[model samples]
Target: MGFCEVVEGRHSIRAFQERDVEDASLEAILRAARRAPSAGNLQAYRVAVARASSVRRLLAQAALDQGFVAQAPVVLVFLADAAASAVKYGRRGETLYATQDATIACAYAQLAAANAGLGSCWIGAFHEDKVRAALGVEEPLRPVALLPLGYPAEVPRMTPRRSLAEMVLDIREDA
Candidate 1:
């Protein structure tokens, strides 16, 4: 699929098959995330790979009982390395750029998963402290997103989207 098709086809998969995700597929996702653009090229992000059922259970609990999270064959936790960005960009790096870097990387990973015919869901509603504790994340590294990956058991319908007229606003001074 082309980039546009990949973007359009990608959806939040909540139900996953018991089949495990291949190592190669997981590597591709991580690689794509690494290639994601970051502020100052700092790449102020890290990803924690979780494949163990015990770990996924803890993550699911941290995710507030999102059972599907635990069911996925693999979970990739995107973390913001604030200190890494701060060293180069100062306060803004710590407060914003680091988060942007993590978020962009997660987006790239999601796309990569879709391109590989794998299912994934981007989860961000978990308690921060719980996720940190569950993943054994230390200071200066903040969890930004939880991506559960596997073969999808269900294919959700296409969700509604705002039209370009409603979502876009062109700012121009000349008529």
Candidate 2:
């Protein structure tokens, strides 16, 4: 599918099939995430792939009882490694770079999953402290998004979106 088609087809899928996602497909998705642009090339993100039942249970708990997280074949926890970036780029990294890096990477991963014929949902509602504890992240590394992936159980209809003219702003001196 073309880029526009992929974008149009993508949706926040909450229901998934029972089949497991292939490792090759997961690798491709991760590779796409790695290719995402980062601030000063300091890819300040870490993805924790949770598949084990126990881990998924903990993640579901951390995600405010979102059972779909545990039900999905793969739950990718995208984390911002502020301390890692700070170590290389100094204190400015935390405030300016790490969050953007992680968010962009997560978006790329979502697109990659769509291209691979998998379904995904970008989950941002969760307790930070609970997520940190559940994922065992060390200090200064924070969870940014939770992505649950698998074959979609139900085909999703397109959601309405604002027109380009409404969302974009053009301020030309000549105009």
Candidate 3:
């Protein structure tokens, strides 16, 4: 599918079918994420893929009882590897660039899933500490986003968006 189509076709899917997502599909998503740009080529990010029922259950609870997180066949938890960023860029890398890199990767993964005819929801409403504990992650790796991926059971109606004029500002200094 075309890039515009991929972007336009995607919706925040909260309901998923009982079918399992193919491994190849997940691999494609990972590939897209891996290509995301990062500060200083550090690629300071890690993804925790949860496929087991017990683990997904814990993730769902950590995601503030967003049950769809557990219902989906897989949940990918994006983590910011702060120490990796800090090694080169120092405090700013740890405090900002690492998180920015992880979020970009998550966005790429979400788009890749949509392009593959898969459904995904960007889940950010969760307790950070709970997420770390659920995923058994230690320090320097912070969970930044949760992505629940699966086949959509319900395709929601398109929501409205702001016009370019309303959303953007032309700062051309010719004024």
Tell me how candidate 3 scores on lDDT.
Answer: 0.95
* Best TM-score among the predictions, by candidate number: 3
lDDT of 3 by residue, 1-175 (tens): 9999999999999999989999999999999999999998899999999999898999999989999999999999999999999999999999999999999999999999999999999999999998999888888899999999999999666889999999998898976
Compute the lDDT of residue 71 as modeled in candidate 2: 87
Give the local distance difference test score of model 1: 0.94
When summed lDDT is taken over every stretch of 10 residues in candidate 1, the lowest stretch is 154-163
In model 2, the runs with Cα more than 4 Å from the true position are none
- Candidate 3 ranges beyond 4 A from true positions: none
lDDT per model, in order? 0.94, 0.90, 0.95
Q: List the residue pairs that clash in candidate 1.
A: none
Q: What lDDT score goes with residue 3 in model 2?
A: 90
lDDT of 2 by residue, 26-126 (tens): 99999999999998898998999988878877888888899988889999999999976787778778876898899999999999999999999999988
TM-score of each: 0.97, 0.94, 0.97
What TM-score does prediction 2 earn?
0.94
